[model samples]
Target: MHILHLPPEVISITCQGLEYRDLVRLRATCRALTGPATDAIRVKAWTVPMYSDCVMYKVRAIGEEEPIFQGYSFKKHFQHHFPQWLEGNLVEVQLLMSLAQEDKEDGLLALKQLTSKLENTHVHVKVVGDYSVDKNEFKQLVEIVATSPPNMTFGIKIYMNGAIGDFFIPDKVTRLCICYCRSIGDFPQFSPTSRCQVHLEIRGGDTDQVLDLFHNACQNSRNLSLAKVTVTVIPLTDPLMSRLETLEFDSVMLVGCLRSTPIPPTKGITCKSMKKLVASNFEEFSYFTSPSLRRVSFVFTDRWSREGNFIGLQRLKKALERCPSLTKVKIQAREHHLGSAETGDYWSDFFNCFEHLEDLEVVIIYSESPITGDCLDTDIIFLGKALPRLHTFCAIDDFGNSYVL
Candidate 1:
């Protein structure tokens, strides 16, 4: 009789002898065989047996849809970044090989020692790499992470060239960053089971691809960061944006702006729960209003406009007007020279909007003809009265001159 004709239990036991790749091939042969092959692969699977750019393995029992975490190399060089971790033999050989491929012995010894250390200590772990691991070592490392004690944090960053298959995303890992990897195939999405904070970063996918993974984070994620990702549009009203305490956008272009203009707390989907927001540049600001927002920062480049004639500044001002709960705000404007017309009580009025403001910092690239100190001094007087709750306020120009009130 063929394998498919065997009893399910017998088929599962037989398939268990096959390696992960072979089982995947076997599972593809027939629809009926997928059940047994999947069980065999799940119950006893391991990472690829060779050292490669990326590795994949299963993290849960057979038949259950557990996430596959794909470990890859990060493009950036971070060899000397973790001197302390390096000194203690906490670095894996595969990760080190990612940095220095010539040192094969060092990589092997490092992997062995790092796996030993993690298995014994179960401490907070961070794995950074550009290299791949052989099957045995990868299996041991996964085991350490799987059995890690509660309260331990785990972070892994993988940078690789092409698509990663069967990526194994472990549960409860605090931070999982995949940089420059191609695609995340079907697996348990990066949704952690516990209340543990999860941070995910995906890079180099189709610009128009909607990140359905974020939807899984609606109720659990504490923060979300997007960099250089081109998505058609992620609605501000998305549940993923609703529950987040902090949202950061870096080099991300949204097809639609969040709440084109501020909407009343009643008519719109207010991110009233978000506490902090950050934008890499003016364009990244989605203008999502949160009645409970306490902190915001925007770094404006010279592209916005020249010197004192800044439309970005005006837009930022308007955005700030809507956040009544803002307590701390920081704005960095490059190549910004405040013309006489842009000066005066205008700033005082701008500062007046944040009634609960506590800390304000403004850094501008002053032009040769910068605003006069006298004018800034006068604005300070008005600001002091309008913002009674202000404690620390400082404005620094590109020339290193500062006025603090």
Candidate 2:
């Protein structure tokens, strides 16, 4: 059958794989194809952000592998999709935009229109822009987002890659992430009534200042996550560390850190309120303990090397024993050769550590490479004998296949 003989729905489905240029080409081919081409052009786009190059914006629609739309100011390119764009069925949307360059004003104007009625939907707006110059415009955007009915879980996150000028964090700001800030200058006034989660990526020069900022944020943010932040010594002795209920650190450099010192006299750094931890350098964290800790996840890019050099494993085992409330654990490793099961059931014995706990989950993920070990010292075996209350256990095999243990 000729292509045009097919129904319009079939033609629309075929257009999904075609690029915008291809769609335009299809539209130019004949008048009959125009309707279908336009329909395909509107593929699943609920919100249109007037895109710019001086800054990048990512409106991450949930479950989408690629962006819904990219390039061209929304006013120019997406006007055709406005009818589809006006669909009030928007359930969840995430819009990320950078306001660094000259085009910010135009982009913000377009964005304000796109987000006007988004108060009823689950909205998360990520602003990677300068706040000082467009202070009023920035606050207006937050006001639009924060006015959501009490049923919605709305969030506004500001990303700072440079210095913070004279500014104040709106009480509506939920999560604030600052990266490599040179000088904080006039510290932003945070409302004592509001709580905001903070993530800081610090540089070697700004280490002391950022650490102080981290501690100050603890009053409002009980959940703190740090990435690539340097510390000459563990600040466990600092009273603020104890107030943290959720602490996450991602530092690949801690694997071979030489300045590692005993965490004071307690044999390990202890957080009375810490309930969950996610760290990349498990070796350095062996000396960390929490009585209320319930879940811990370890992701490493290092190899186990040999059975004799399991200092990280030994220390973590002791640390796990100290946490009487630990119930769920996840270990994800990549590019690391955890050696074969030549020695014993040491890998299986690692699960034995949880034998004392009730209701537990153990997840072990390994790199599926020749150098990487496929099994955990023992071939896949149900850990039911070791963990009677094993809630969920997932592990990979020799072929990198995952199966329940």
Candidate 3:
């Protein structure tokens, strides 16, 4: 049978099975079938690049006025499949755009249209633009997105040089990430019902007030991360800490109150429901005790005093004593610290604490001092015996080779 004799629907299905390059060849074969063949190729090309409902907008390295994806015929196909995809999948759509040199209006317009079509779809807008943008112009864009749909679920993330003002986030937004945004005095407030998973890398802000805001608006949040913030004092009874299931802190300071006016510790902050925690400092883990914790990770650094006061993983040793349900543990320690003779005692103590750990991973970053073969073998054997439920043990050698034992 001649290919041209096939019905349009049959042709469409057949073309869908062809590779992108093959479809390109099919387009040139016959002028009569070019349109249908090209449409099928467009659908696959567009959907292939959408990673988890994300539309990555790319621009030329040199002089280019428009995004590479602009004026493409894939929008129609995207809208057709979006509803079906969202039926079972989470309604989280991300629009990542390059705003480094061009106007941000186009990206915002695309975000608005996408949210408009998928009612109540949670949108996460990420823009790579000039951090030093005009405040007034940026504010206008912010208002448009914030007020687009009265009941829309949306989140706006931008790297701005200046401090953020009182901008509204749609109550239904589930995640918000803002890096290098300075909010010195006043930070944006969320709705009472907002439970957004916040990841803020703030530069200049009264972090104590920021923590205070979390208690007020983000009471329902389960996952929270704060990076590069000067945390003055973290009370054991903060409402936000009580409900968290996953918490992460990187380069966060904990300046305990002065000796005269110290807040009475309420037997350390207890999160009976927490399952995972990743932190750079080990001392912070002491305050959090999760009976249901399954996974925990820590980044060990040289500046123990600057990060936290824990001598040779003592706090981590104590912290693990509480997480009886832990199943996985990851420790990334500086090479010098782990290779020293004194750490041998600590490792023995640390390994003795795990009982239900199934997956264990360790990365000892090598510098002037590297871990020896004997050290690695001993640790692996110790781990295998200590963890009866252990099934996988992984470690990275000095040559960056990952070995599974």
Candidate 4:
């Protein structure tokens, strides 16, 4: 009888199907349903599910039960030199991920049947980003490859832990594609191949002679993401860009494009102290020019991947007209479905390229997922009325909830 005598559109369509610790215990038993249950929990509904300490690179797959991908890796080469590069009586594993251009050749034929018959295991394969690693040293090299023996192939070691936070990242980073590999760890020490490679003992130290005695990657990096690697002397070429003359990055997150090695591109670079830039390929928005950039994050991948957000939006509106100090923005996607109508003019030129960011206040979005689907409330209320120093806008994810666009 008295559901506040109903109608605030039936209490936001019955508290929009409750769940956020039961709508905060029904807005603590009504104080006028706590402003419609905090606007129905910012219109996101609910789903936190774990993982988000502002996420500083993460990944998983060891007795997988769910959680598997948020991206950002190496917590000190997997908590300290990845257990000293896979210790003894050996069988090691390292297989990192980011391969979803239709699971690139069936994930390298399921990792060459998990490394074509192991015989005294020692695996090393790094196809940068997504699902590839092993350690106990990585969970005891996947429990000695489930009790080894059979055509032989068990030991997949890959650790992209290029010291960050004490800074020592000179990981010569070799972008690999494991075509039934042998040796490939993109130097620091580990290169041997007449046919198939395996060797690791960066242990007497020589990762660029300890990153050349810490120049702190060009004096205490504020933020930097340099990909476009190379350093092959024994089979492996093209991928070298250590262009550091000046960089005082504040934030730069370009993540996406790797359905099996496909990122090589560079011939543009300029930064007078980047504030924030997260671009997922548009050929790196003409490769970056931050006029003291403020904040930007656009990463969309899934719907089976086509190299994240390949819609360019007129090359991100000429790279947001060369950052007029972007106020703040973040967009994350996981199931990436631009809600029908053949992507609706790429979200109508992605909301008319932020109406000239004017001095944009804030706008954070994470569609397709935060942990799985649907969060595009009419293109976020049509990008909060097509920006103009947007006061604030929201819609977080990982399914805890977020709304207010």
Candidate 5:
């Protein structure tokens, strides 16, 4: 039967089952499928990377809906000066470093234009860049954004290796994610207590630097409840600990050996409130010891050992032992390894580690080889033996097609 003839509710359900490309095609079939299909598209769009870019180019190109202007991207060919387009109409702007170096005049003009259009809008500005911006330019950009909206929230991510001077920001910002940036020089400089929530992600830095930044954030955010603090740090330490609701660590970098000792607790810090953790790495496997963590995601990279094989799995097993409350676990690993004999054993062992996991997603890079009998049988066996609590088992192969349960 044709999809258009189905009841709206049924069509919605069916649309949700289809791949994103298929849904887009269905939306073009006729008006009967348009409404439900569009809703599905929007929901799916948000989950997809660069959703704003897609909406801006596709939906806007056809004069459907004006896409939300969440941030700006400068056209590279145009002297790298100003943004070629503004994305997402949301009051918040997240400007990545890759798109920040357009000509200063063009960027400033575009910012002015954007502010004019979004004035009186309670906006949040997140500038992600290395500290390559000139002092006056950076100050000017901050001042302009702050002046535009009193209720605005602003944040800056300076690369960990770069130097930055003290700057004032509006008190509207309650959430922040700082990647690879260290040195919180003064603890009281930034008052985070007035805000409702705060998040910090530290990457690619020394353990001392990471601890200093975390401690500074905690000390300044006193008025905020401990539950509002969330931190992600590599080489986890006790001094950097806080009574956070969400605590994450890059395990591959932190856990050097399976026998590595856990960081001891600090005198005033408590991590009992943590609810989520992420362990990612390219080398050795990592683990977490959060008793209250509800979700854990592992991101594996293409790294080879002296024997030309992937890193340790026992470390990962050890990590899983610490997260008893884990309901969801996602493993993003290389596809070739997943289909290999070694990988089959690793997958089996990994599954055995999760006793309470309800949602399991395994994303493997694509490969051209057909699913051999050995690989297929191994996967079937693993799936069959998975935890009884497992409700959603999804495997996305290299080609992006999903095997869902």
Candidate 6:
């Protein structure tokens, strides 16, 4: 069989399955195969790494004006060229650049050029870096993105630099994520009328500043449906309590006023929209009075300061009594014996607090002496029958074993 007699379409299709590096070799085989193989090469260019390490390749058409690279070289090599085989359909355009101080000029220029190209097309931009962009650069970037159509989704990860204030929030962004930022003051304002759905995770900050930011943002937001809001707070506030749909507070200490304010019978500040809540300190549990709440997760750490114990189990019991709509509840107790015969009585009393709960997940980390088998069995039986609405029961040991409930 003379392979040379094969149709061009047949040859091109056959080469489609070859790896990118191997395709280059096949293209060099003969002039006849080169044309089809070149087309194949273009087709594979779409899958090339768009965002890697700290470098972002700002791509554009071949004849378009060349982007200024400053001192850095912009290789005009064919390897970086757009493949002709691509159907000219614009999908997502990702721009990556190292935020190194030396690379600042080139990075800014690349950003400018990329923004200009994006102005004419419906391409989503994902900017990933740890460096701090100046206020002027960040403002320009935000203006370009905000003015774009609302359908475009933009993702940006600016590493922890005290400079988050420089980046102004773009109004049209549909989804946003901020990680490892130094403070929440740099976060954008969320208006109730704003169309964006936000996911914010603040890993580091002074607790008061974090809570202040959360309260301010929630108050300004017209629609309170955030995808999720997770923060570590030293103290919790009532204002930040009412707005979130899904809330996670870790390493929080129940400080300030603990006087049991009678939970308003009408359901305090109805977070009819809340679906999930995770609190590490029971003293801070007073904030979960939403009638629309679906899930509640409690984590009791052994590392709790003296202030945490001051809030006491009584306050926690009253807080749970008010959450009538809670469907799932998870309790993670650390450094607390929750299954001793004495603790069994405490468990029986505590389980009675969540009368309306349907699904229960409990993790007890015993200290010193291991949990006795009889004590564990007694607590499991008490919880299973105590909550009449309960359907699924999970009792995890210190090692994360699920004992039958």
The number of the candidate with the highest lDDT is: 2
Model 4 residue runs over 4 Å out of place are 1-9, 12-135, 141-184, 187-287, 290-321, 324-356, 363-389, 392-405
Clashing pairs in 2: none
lDDT of 1 at 311: 58
Query: Would you estimate the TM-scores of all the predictions?
Result: 0.47, 0.52, 0.50, 0.24, 0.53, 0.43
| lDDT tens per residue, model 1, 1-405 | 788788888887777787655565455345466453464342322222124222223222334333222233232322212222222322121232222345444434444444453453333344545323323444444665677555345555543334434445566455555443355433223443533333333333431222455444444444433322332333444443343324443222234333332432223334545666565545545345666666666655534434445554566666676776676677665544456565543344334444434443322222222334446666666667667666556766556666677
For each of the candidates, the C-alpha root-mean-square deviation to the true structure, in angstroms, is 20.9, 10.7, 11.6, 20.6, 9.2, 13.7
Please give, for residues 321-342, the per-residue lDDT of candidate 6 as tens digits.
Answer: 6776666666665565243444
Between prediction 4 and prediction 5, which has the larger TM-score? 5
The positional error of residue 271 in candidate 6, measured at the CA in angstroms, is: 4.7
- What's the C-alpha lDDT at position 187 in model 1? 21
- List the lowest-lDDT window of 10 residues for candidate 2: 52-61
lDDT of 4 by residue, 1-405 (tens): 777888778777777676444553455345465454444332101011112111112222233222222344445432222222112212344443224454445544444544453334444334433223321333333333344444233223344334222211122222221111232223222222111222221222233432332223323332223321211221111121123215333544443322223544445566667676656634443466778777777664433323336444555566777887788867665554544443444544454566677788886667554332243456556666666558677656675856565
Candidate 3 vs candidate 4: the TM-score winner is: 3
Off by over 4 Å in 1: 1-123, 128-151, 159-164, 178-184, 187-196, 202-210, 213-272, 301-314, 336-372, 375-389
> lDDT of each model, Cα atoms only?
0.45, 0.49, 0.47, 0.42, 0.42, 0.47
Least well predicted 10-residue stretch by lDDT in candidate 4: 44-53
TM-score for model 3?
0.50
lDDT of 5 by residue, 178-263 (tens): 44445433222355646534344443345356545566655766553322322344334433333231443322123322223264
- In candidate 6, position 404 carries an lDDT of 52
Instruction: Write model 2 residue lDDT over 185-288, tens digit each, in one string.
Output: 33344666656555554333344555566667655545433432323333434432333324454321222232333354353466555566665456445545
